[model samples]
Target: MKKFFTILGILILVLVFVGTAVFLFNKSKEKPVVYETSSPFITDIIQKTVATGKVIPRKEVNVTSQVSGVVDQLFVDAGDTVAKGDIIAKISLAPNMIALNNAESQLESAKISLSNAERELERQKNLKAQRLVSESEYNKFLLDFELKKERVKSAENNLLLIREGSTLQSDLVSNIIKATSDGMILQIPNKEGAFIVESSTFGSGTTVATLADMNDMIFEGMVDEAEVGKIREGMELLLDIGALDSEPFQAELEYISPKGQQDQGTIKFQIRAAVKLQDQVFLRANYSANADIVLDKREQVLAINEGNLIFEEGAHFVDVETAPQQFERRQVETGLSDGINIEIVSGLVESDKIKQL
Candidate 1:
């Protein structure tokens, strides 16, 4: 019985030892989490927002006809430079036989009326010299003769204009469409024989061509209402034209619309920026571009990757690896952040290491 009790006691000790060994093996099998660390360095931090828009000229104009007629000639084509008062196109007057005949008849009648008024005035003057006519009668005859002459001149001028597009006394023609400013012809829709309708107050008629001053290009974009307040006139911007696939260009904010547009339950305001071109880059009208507005820029700032930061209890902190398997929670003073990286004002140095959790 003593031997059996001793054996039982040894069995109990062996069981306890096996249990402890199993527990330690299971604990050792657990996966250990690894951490990444980086050192803070002085860098440039720029906070920016992207906006999509197009490259437009500072001034663009659509040249249209003033009268409806067949296009007789196209004086300029696309890419041609034109000056103010330069004729862009000419329109042929359509058949309006009735109107033309009436104008002609009216002119002839006015000439006859003027001749009769002159003869009557001469007779009145002679009668007045012999004291046969009153002074008021002679004055009335002289006034009537002068008024009739003016009417004859006006009628003849109108008739000449209706027949030949212009009169000897007039400088303008209804059929000739001229440029209002010095610019390049961006488009010419109507060919030499295409018919065009004139623009009227009631409606916008056919557009003959588009004229634009390509020398001055502007970047037009929109900013969300939430970000519009952060943007203002005179702010510098970086522009990227997707089509060019080249380097970004520089621009300055020039205009911001006071009103906002409601789209998809979000408000956006229109903005215009003047981009000075280098080497006269060919920027077609409405070319797609992205404007990057730099809201903040800082140089030589101590910054770290934003992934290393931890926000807790209204304080920004980071895990610092002081030694092997040792880490400490440290609070840091931060300034401007550039989304990907944050500016660290204090509580960290370039030589110190940061653990990303």
Candidate 2:
């Protein structure tokens, strides 16, 4: 019985040793991973931030009425070019009958008093000349006559204002709204009879017309807060309008919002750039566009495909191809990158070959 038990133990130990040997043999035979490589070359490296917004004129005016009245006639239509003081619309006075009648009655009463004073003045003058009245009494009557004449003139002027909106004679037109500047009428919200309200502290009021100089076009976009600090005013910009195809338009950075706004949980800053549009190309206000403000640019920079770079433990590394199917690790000092290619400011010249994967 003891001999049989000892044989079973020996068999189990042999089987364990065979399994361990097979596992070690398979692990040692495993193949090394093959990596792809690419060589560094001279290329342009441009860095920019993309923003989505609309195309608007640099100078736009919302022509509004200063006085509230019924719109009688519209002289200019949309797309019409208007000069300063050009009549854009006309407002007919909605006469206030009660106020007009009250003013007229006051003027008539003042005139009647003026007539009585004039007669008294005449009588006093004649009496004084004939030595029939005292000089002090005649002087007092003359002063009252002159005061009554002034009061009648004031009453008449007030009557004219209530009836005609202005005291000027020669049948002056009422509320002829004119353009404040020379610009193209982009929009005429009020047609022939659209009533527009005057701009007040409460709001901008109803916009009568939208005028803009189409020649002065600009691109408005937003930059991510992460990149807003790197941009500044007067930086050259390249604008790629989706409607204009791949041909990028040129512009200059004009403004960067000082305050940050949260959008989709990501903070972003607003940026505006003045774009120089072609004379023939007409750009409407609020046209969507993408802008690239080049923070830094290089003509012919030593660059490599960004894919060739490898990251490990907070350090940047790359695989350089030494021979066919052979690669070695290389540390690179990089400069600005356009997100697709990386600029090699130092380390790894054009002669070095790099792996893409």
lDDT of 1 by residue, 18-67 (tens): 99999999988969877767789899999998888999898999888777
Model 1 weakest 10-residue run by lDDT? 158-167
- Candidate 1: the clashing residue pairs are none
Per-residue lDDT of model 2, residues 95-137, tens digit only: 5688778888988999999999999899889999999999999
Runs in model 2 lying further than 4 Å from the true structure: 1-37, 133-154, 169-174, 198-205, 312-317, 328-331, 346-353
Question: RMSD of each candidate?
Answer: 5.9, 6.8
Instruction: State the lDDT at 41 in candidate 2.
Output: 88
Where does model 1 exceed 4 Å of error? 1-28, 31-33, 95-98, 114-150, 200-204
lDDT (Cα) of model 2: 0.81
Candidate lDDT (C-alpha), each: 0.88, 0.81
What value of lDDT does candidate 1 attain over all alpha carbons? 0.88
